[model samples]
Target: MATSSNFFIHTFLISSLTFFPLSPSLADDDTDKPVVEQLVDTLSTIAGPHPGIRKNHAKGIVVLGEFTPSAEASSVSSAEHLQSASTPVTIRFSNTTGIPDIADTNPSSFPKGIAIRFQLADNSYTDIVSISVNRFPVATPEDFLGLLNAVAASGPDTPAPKPITQFLASHPAAKTFVEIEKPAPVSFATQPFYGVNAFKFINKEGEVNYGRYQIIPVNGPEYLTDEQRAAAGNNYLFEELPKRLKQNKAEFILALQLAEKGDEVNDPTMVWPETRQLVKLGTLTIESIDPNGEQFAKQTMFNPLALTDGIEASKDPILLARPSAYAISYGRRLSGQ
Candidate 1:
């Protein structure tokens, strides 16, 4: 007999199929209803609605730190936030999915989240939101919603080649994303996060460079073995970070993978070639976990579009859709819904 956890996982996989059938109709509606509303509605259906809760990555811890710019960084962008001696930073680490209490060891929890906020000299702040996975499943917001809707459409009673199968068949990138193995990290500090969307970096000379952000752990990446995974607890990732931080600071190198002329900046689903140059922008040293980390994580909203001068969002539709989707999520949480 399957355990409760196994049952939940099985049900979730089937329920996800319900989403695909709804996608085409929603995509064609062209209604004045904000895309964020539709996105949230779709997410709520898949994750199950929970008032005062985030639609995804619901469990997380926030840490306070300072970002020290690299001497070499001065050549990349003239953004004042990056030029400052030291900018205060807030970083949040979280598991995947909106199921708040999902087991950390679950396969559904593979692609974790890392959201950062840099407090600038003028008291303004900018955010960089990333995930453990380098590539996104879909290129546009419409397709992402469609993908979710496809998953939601699947049920235990649905046919073997369900809507999700058909959806993945048409969306090759989505199929690849689903098929990829995203192993659980031993700890949040051991994961390498990637900002899937591309951004424009403007230098002092007004020259522009397009690149994606990459956050690599200074201690290097680490993952659990099968034996280790079998022995870990449900809340191991959340529990391990605080203890680890007490022993030593966690650090990550902030770098950018520059895009060549032919690279597609508009599609986040298409990852850039690995041959691109990587420029070090700064180092993030997380000295300690915030005592009120959980509360802070619950209340704060990290917006990728909340950018400062010299850095701007790309033309990616999915990227453009993020701020509004985040706003909707923030408002719902604040209203205690």
Candidate 2:
């Protein structure tokens, strides 16, 4: 018996709203529909760039956090002991809404976590990253910035497009984002960050397969509320991280979320229902810690493009634009302005 599943939730069906310029030579409209994802070709007129908001975010870096994934099977370590077979690990942790100096105690900020690129032993491909953030970019680069600008912006609809600064002032959520820059109730080391990608796994049998990586905090992921913010004050967030690393072993496991075909391609808004099942890939425990000074922070770059093989990018759009922007930003920092 054949079965049907709509799976097309509004958030996921968002691809329906995106525009992709395919080769116009298609014989007919029916033929023009994409086999992977079906979206309206007319998405351009309905949409304009939604300029994402950026607060010239500046935090110090860890000279120790410096390590890149290699195309070969290597190990993750420092000047001393070498351990686990190292894959390229591009990790980033940030509060979605934050200014330079704010308390790290706000749950709404969703201290964003990242570990984009990692290599497999043979290095045929890379593990996909940001399949969770937004979807269209994987389809085309334009969607990443396009959809972002739309969501974050008030747009050209006004008699005059208000400067983003003005629009953000009107939108309280935007302001709250900056106010709660580092809102971590306890220590950020406790939160569980996701690697929202449906990876393609293949075997020597010429068969194809799929999966994703999961990072579970061994001890944390504490959430802070508004009331907690008034008491904690600004330095509280920065204070908690090192305290956790010092008091507890503060470790997280890297696991995999294997996938079958056609999981919810719609509601790009919800997390792709992971079985939440995890397979142990590696472990990340804060060993030697350092200060968040300008030298360590300013010089670092986190680009999604720099991945090792075995992991593959999915048919999502937002994940597409990161590499270019990240590389440019990385180069700018290295240039030492």
Candidate 3:
């Protein structure tokens, strides 16, 4: 029997063939375009061009922290970075979409992002990047571009059966991703974050496991009520985080959701079943706001692919394409474009 998800994908493919058929030459032309450039172009269409700013998740705050691996973490990895020791960290929390001044209460800012750079014991560094949502809208880079294109086509003068509606009618996962209501969080520290991409983790005994990373907030998950959302300031998250840090340290547990033998390791769109086991890897504690927040935000480039010996990225096309897309954004920022 076909799963609902499988049926959806099959139906979507058939609908796409009928409504948006492409010639062989057109398909080849699309394949020839760089993923990074396509990503930037898609973002520009959605949010308008903002030179020198990130293509998405532009509004953010930078902070300083430390990561202390759990006692059990060392058993899983001989990597010096995983040893139970205090490692300095640079952390940034941001809202989704490319609008730099978007209000925190806006629905477009539903899936917030967290990026952390850990300065390892060996004087090297690694980065972990995650978002509040666990599942992605599309499986592949091409599908993601198509979703963006659909959004771009639905302008003020768009006729009935909007491009996004047509796209959603075919793509069930993307439809679900858009339809899901992600309420506003009370503060960045109160929301749980998930590393949507799968990664291979190697243990000291050379045992390798595929899993996605999760960051569970020590403060517990909290959200703003509709009334609270209406009353909040445009930069509530930005204001709340620093004020909360001053009152008490913010913390989160780092965990891994291990995949079963048959899990889809390369498709971020397919979330692993909840029955999978979870291993607590470490704790991340944000002690204070960075005094030089502006400078730190400007200088830091948080790449998800920056990994140590124990961890390696999976073959997910979206995961593989991130570094290059990030580099394009980073270069524009550095050149003051």
Candidate 4:
């Protein structure tokens, strides 16, 4: 239903995994290839439906100064920032691995990555950044090989018999994050994790530092139920987006959580919880979008690597993988320009 480049972060990486885990055949489920195979097949189908969105798929992963936020939080009050929200923003949302011609109305689809840019006070812009629903780095570039293994190990559609228990089956390093260890259809209820790939900070004085960001859904998190996900609509948000955004506004508040220094490095599999509740940084609202209309289909970019000065990225491994793949796909979409 959506397409973008800043939105591109998930396009390349996620589309690559529309597969089941690899494992010896289960009695009734021994008919599929490695999960990676299915994932690739699924993506090949959704990668080319929207013309403009696809064009945007052809741009830069992230340009250093284009849209980074200040290194530190500003003296600007959160209230002021919220009040300043009058500055309207336009965003492009798209499923990175959706099948071509897929119906946006389906609930089983993967989340469309989000790429957002704001017109700042100085008229400068912020680089596009992707906000994904899945927080676990299991899907990040850092977990590539291991993720492939999970899909390789399990059968498609067969939820690992013992989710928490099976997740523990992979052993520590067998999987990138605890998430992938989770057999099939990780629940949004129990596992709403983020790549926490990269981030930037803003100082009231306008100083900036690169950083990482993640969210822990407010409702203890829940994944789509079995029936709602039948049409490959494994995740219900797929069905919810069109409905909510059409009703005037769609909003998701993501508190900002920064990675403290001296912690793990390039460890995309790590999890940082509410032990440090996210700093209430901002709220994302989608005023309204015509799921199949021109504006949503054309004119929106969403490369997660895109950013503003107050939000620079780091040399984090997963963060680093974005530029090339993101740029190529985004460029192809924007090439005629």
**Positional deviation of 337 in candidate 4, in angstroms?**
14
* Candidate 4 per-residue C-alpha lDDT over 1-337 given as tens digits, one digit per residue, 9 for 90 to 100: 1223112222333342322122222232523543333323233334545443442222111111112222222422222232334434554444334343444323223433445555566675454444344333353442453444344333334354523234435545323332332212322222233445546556546654333444343444445445544544333434454554456444444455555655453554455544643454455445555344443433343455555544555656555655554454445446531
Write the residue-wise lDDT of candidate 3 on 163-214 in tens digits: 7678888988887766566778888999999988999888889998888999
In order, how many clashes per candidate?
18, 41, 0, 94
**Which pairs clash (backbone N, Cα, C closer than 3 Å) in model 3?**
none
lDDT of each: 0.77, 0.38, 0.76, 0.40
Report the candidate with higher TM-score, 1 versus 4. 1
Q: Best by lDDT, which number?
A: 1
Better of 2 and 3 by lDDT: 3
Maximum-TM-score candidate = 1
Q: State the local distance difference test value for candidate 2.
A: 0.38
For every candidate structure, what is the RMSD over all alpha carbons to the true structure, in angstroms?
A: 4.1, 12.4, 6.7, 10.4
TM-score of each: 0.89, 0.56, 0.87, 0.57
For candidate 1, what is the lDDT? Answer: 0.77
Write model 1 residue lDDT over 263-285, tens digit each, in one string: 99989878988999999899999
Report lDDT (Cα) of residue 166, candidate 3. 86
